[model samples]
Target: MTVLHQLRRALLKPPSFTQAYGGTRTLTSPYHTENNSTAFIKPDDQNNRKTQGKWLTLPPFNTTINGASLGKNIAGIRQSTGEGNESTTTAIKWVMRCCPQLPRSLVQKLFRLRQVRRKPLESSNSVGDVHASECQVKRVSAKDSMRFGDTVYLPITVEASPTEKTECLCTEEELKFLHDLELYKDSAIIVINKPTGMPVQGGIGIKRSLDELAGTYMRYELSEAPRLVHRLDRDSSGILVLGRTQYSATVLHSIFREKTIGASNIDLKSEKRFLQRKYWALVIGSPRRPQGLISVPLGKVVMDDGRSERITVVENVSTTASQHAITEYRVLDSSFHGLTWLELSPLTGRKHQLRVHCAEVLGTPIVGDYKYGWQAHKKWNRIQIASSNLEHKIEVCNKSSLPFGLNLESGSIADKQPNLHLHCKKMVLPDVSSAIKQACISSSDYDFADIKSLKFDAPLPPHMQRSWDILSS
Candidate 1:
């Protein structure tokens, strides 16, 4: 009998495999073909089969065998195509979706073992030999991109059910909330008005960080999760950008890094990719000058406890530990009641750069920034200037006469210790999606002007709005 017939007979009488193995070895497990059931070979049988070094050339499947489904078969050959929403998915991710119970390592092992296969991209139905090596058992990589309509073949099915699930940590309500936060979206990027108190990335005790939430729910329809391009403080609310694809993420990361390092050399109008971030902060006191730039080199200094760190203006700029930090500030509106609204634009990105410059360099501390401005807050309480009527010579605070932090109508105390008033109000950057495609065709010939710069503005958060209302009045 042929090898195919011998294998068929062996599968039919699994317990009596002595006829096939010449009574040297015995079959311990029957091949399962159910979708949920695992189709795998036992360890001894696998070793025996490997020693025999026999390759089974399966014909194009017409019907089920041993109740084996097309997609699920333990020992039976099968073909699966990349279908549904994914335009292009990695081989590893596709395998994980097909077999949820299979561990990532085992899926990778299947690829490494040449058990998984795919038809060559340039193959055709009218090609020469019927049993030609069109779908050879090669070492398929996990990162290999599987385009839509691509058929993947498997000679043997792997075990399932004993592996841990890889599911998103976010609940349905959290996902809905994140969906609402999306300010702008395209194939390449996603911009969100990040809420205060929600961290960009997870930490020691942070359960639901924005990055994790975005990666889970903010996929929209893309194959990969959106990745954070920049960072915003946990207590600050503002426009945060995310990249949907690997190429987009790399482009954005490089742009931000270049801007931070060589801010002075960059020409905004000429360089279309040049990124700009405008911030609006409410500070305790006004700057000495109405508008000017603060060029200070900042360094991280360890506090007395040795566990905590603080970013402070360093006297020596030449040190490797210190980075040159520059911020341009303009007093938008100032009130006699010890509050000033300042518009800030940072030329260089440094940790706590704006906060340190506002508090130390400008002698004005941002309102509600307790970490860097606690001393200023303790020195000044919210003084109610009762005399509403003011001369034009002095800046008149004109608006509703509502008191700060206390609602007289509701008799409820507002957020006493409000979040940081620093907000990333606006962002101007290149259209990354179009830019990427344009570069792919001919980068040298590509003109940056072909794509318009994207401008986004985020409104003030509730606490800041409330504070602004109280200050304006």
Candidate 2:
């Protein structure tokens, strides 16, 4: 054959050739016709065919291959695949089109190398440890700096030394008082009528609290002392529930967190149990409407002196620093003395929500509230003083602070006015059976078959009763 015709025939042949009768195959170079075993496909021709899917020739079996060049070729293929320019199907199709002698199964196996090498990098460390470290960083940075007037303040944390566990002490009279305070009790829970001037939980300089007394009171019936499921303000008397068992406590906590009682009737009638609490309060003046719902956000503002904090209606709703609080109030009775008796049902359990709502939103603070109440004793002097020369007065008082303004001390206002006139009158607990069933579904360890649903009503405390008697009379 002519040299030109042989060259053209080599160009027309496929890149990878197989013997037409399938034994051993020989690759002939386009430049040589001597049947040399050292002949190879030119680098330029191989690269151009790789890119353009054109036909070229493969090297003889004994031909020496450059390890570095082979690595570069594999890397180029991986890069193209990574960039989404080449997929497994496209690679297989290209391999078949350019090298018809290559098997489809072998091409599939070669494509799997990309996936094997591209596995996601995983760490040996636990995710919880990383999350806990992040939380520590956030906690360190969350120390709030509060400003009031000219002072910048930060809260101080006091660490107390561990004290010996001592049995609570109670006098016979006190024991009788505690027994009388029991509004309701069952296998799962105990409802107590907390009294005014009694702290629910001990605090700085406080030696005795209702919780201590409760421990002594229930020590006879329970091997493990009953645990208070929730807390009421120190001076705000009302119904309190104590869980007698761990399962009951967990269930009660979930109910309170979900605000089950305040949910709709459909929710109450569902499989889950619900609870409802009601309180009565006497505030100075009446709301413009006889009955209404107050929806406001509340946030605590530390005083400029850093000695105390006060709950107030958050004026700005855009910030996440404030919590949403809602309360429904009805004017039960209005007295000639400019006081109105109100029945309040809080929809959300925010600290001092009712107090802030009544004082700020309704323009009528509770009668004995010293912090958020009307400053009845502020003396206004009309002497025309220069605004620049007048110094702003700093007023400070120490009173028990409660969430949302519960039973805060009246301070100087207590001398003239009575104690906090708010009282938790009644509480409705969810059906014990339904709650236990739900708890069982959530946890296999729970079995509340012995517990029964309960409702309790607490008579108005002496201070509130006196005010009602005088105002109604």
Candidate 3:
């Protein structure tokens, strides 16, 4: 059978909920009715219906009358009784007594009968109960810069941008793109908004990355180029952080490595503080706008078969030796554009953490993800770069029949999907020592065309550029 068929068979297995576990062990979501009785009527489940559907719509937990919230819902029950117009003294009083935690904005939405209410915040990394520490406010001067020393904060943003303006970096002639730099300080960190279709780092068999752009920008500005502190998947787009000084790199690296707050960890305040990382990806299907926190434990799947790419997640191995992983997400927008714009925040660092969590646990696989429970490779070949294209080079002489069509002599084959889809859009942090802060850079924006000129695409062979252009566009 085909790889997609195999994947479907693997992922869509019917739940055997009743075969072994029976009545008392029925699986439940954050707000299951069986747990809370008042507002939730446990539909005549007397005889125990054995069969059920695989997918689930969000549960209802809020109640309202007329146009106001009677109260919040939890464990399948409304906190207060619903009454006329849900606005006057009675409704408000009930809510005040039983559901004081229901904020006014949320109460209004519920009263208006909006969809997709927030689920419980019981998970370790959920909005409530953050156990991380806080740091004091700090700043650094250009003189104390990492290029100078970690004694000061490094400024990353180099230009200003119109608030709420989403740059459409992908153009008709270009499928791959980069962001316009707003403020690029000589030290600290630099932020570049990457466009879809470009790799953040190389080695998809060999390709260009934002790494190559630093040198070009340095030449134009006659300043030092920044170094990449974190990474974004090639097919995705958005903002990225790069360090310009060794001290900045060392400091930022420590935060991420240790999972420290402001370094890359969540603390008591739920501030989402860190050398924080966030992203906006266009996912698949019509999903809940603000949904997703895959708390499944994850472990890497290594292969002894010598395949260069790892499988990321082992199949059907939940509740095993995997490390805990939390991926928070909210849908920004969606359509048959065959994509859903998403704001993703990863709580724990794991290899392929977000990608695997999105697919296996959350059930919303990224649009162009080829591995980790998607279809396996349909065709394969070595991606090519010239002797001059690569800073380091070696001959890729093919010794056997190629799986996909190939000249074997010439090196020019892109990976499946042509372009990967995963981007690093924004990052947040609270108490970073100004000594390592890259977020301190000023903010400025650049034109789409100007951002494109920073790469070495001019020397790309015509056929390769044409294909690159086609895939990117």
Candidate 4:
């Protein structure tokens, strides 16, 4: 026989130990031809076509591995298939795309712990065949390439099973409370006037939050729950926005982030890509200028307790940690009793920016803002008490300026704690519902009538209105 014929015959010879084993064994070997293409062949007893493999070009080891036909492996786990082309995405990128809410740092930590795994590329079996047991437990690196059919296994910590968690985090009453607060709702977004003293998200010692309640009961007919697009402070009552869909949430988040970072470049009068938030604050004193901008840099300072932190105006303009804050203020009404109603428009979003600017920069701290305006409140109380005449004594004593039936007595009692007077009264931003619908449906046929900016107005909370009435009277 020729050398080539002899080599092929020898390669097809079965191993002597195969007879001792119960099941049939299959082996694939690559044969190179003159054209530099490689083909694989297997030895079989029944069919000649089954013995001859198809000619194919193998990709590099760094590329994604080929996937097997849809079949359960030895562990009864269904194997996924890959596309014909190679995938350029990394393992971590693929995981993040599958789970958008997961933090990147946590994914890196999982990779470091070797919790990310995948099925072996070579273990892919044909239709109705079972892969080796080891194939189901193979771990992969985060830097590894992800193929279309590759099954990337993340740890249980990454993807929690619904069966594992039996208890519901939100109660029925809380869900109803959230539903009652909804100001507007559509397919893309849900707007609510968040109540004062209620937290938007949970933290340490927080048993309940608005986000948990909304996600539990606000799903309606959608498969996924609503997600918060922006946050409102725990003590501030305002128009809070939540995205009903993932795409809308992502788009709204990007738009809000852009508005906060570059407020000067955004045109407030523009019909698109603009966010206008107007606040009504009951301040202790009136601004010297009727209406102007308060440009100041603010920074956070942790208290000596190491836990409590507060936002304050940074005296040094060169400080890198400080954030630039701009707010437009117009004096609405002033009272002879040392009170002023001010309309505030914050150009940039910052933590407690309005409270800090009003107290430190403009010297007119918001009423009931004890963190920044405690001293001003005490002075106003003393002045009002000293100048009290017998004629107006009964009126002042019967109707206190403080809300929630509380007086100016300072203590740990609930009656002494006052509510914040800074309220988010109005907002104007791009119509997220229309934008999402237009992107999903036919763009050419979409109507532009409802695409105009969405306008929302929230009335002041009872406490704020009472403070306004006291000031006006």
Q: After superposition on all CA atoms, what RMSD does each candidate show versus the true structure?
A: 14.7, 30.0, 27.8, 16.2
Show where candidate 1 strays beyond 4 Å.
1-173, 267-273, 385-415
Give the TM-scores of the predictions, in the order they appear: 0.64, 0.54, 0.40, 0.63
Candidate 4: RMSD to truth: 16.2
Question: Backbone clashes per model, in order?
Answer: 1, 7, 34, 2
**Least lDDT summed over 10 consecutive residues: which range in candidate 2?**
150-159
Q: Candidate 1, residues 367-445: lDDT per residue as tens digits?
A: 8788889999888766543334322212323224322111212100024465688899999976776665553444233
Residue pairs clashing, model 1: 39-74
Candidate 2, 314-390: lDDT as tens digits: 88878647887777789999976677889987766788877788889998777667678747313211123233432
Candidate number achieving the greatest TM-score relative to the actual structure: 1
Better of 2 and 4 by TM-score: 4
Give Cα-based local distance difference scores for all models.
Answer: 0.60, 0.51, 0.38, 0.60
What is the C-alpha local distance difference test score of candidate 3? 0.38
Model 1: how far residue 338 lies from native, Å: 0.9
User: In model 3, where is the ten-residue run with the lowest total lDDT?
Assistant: 150-159
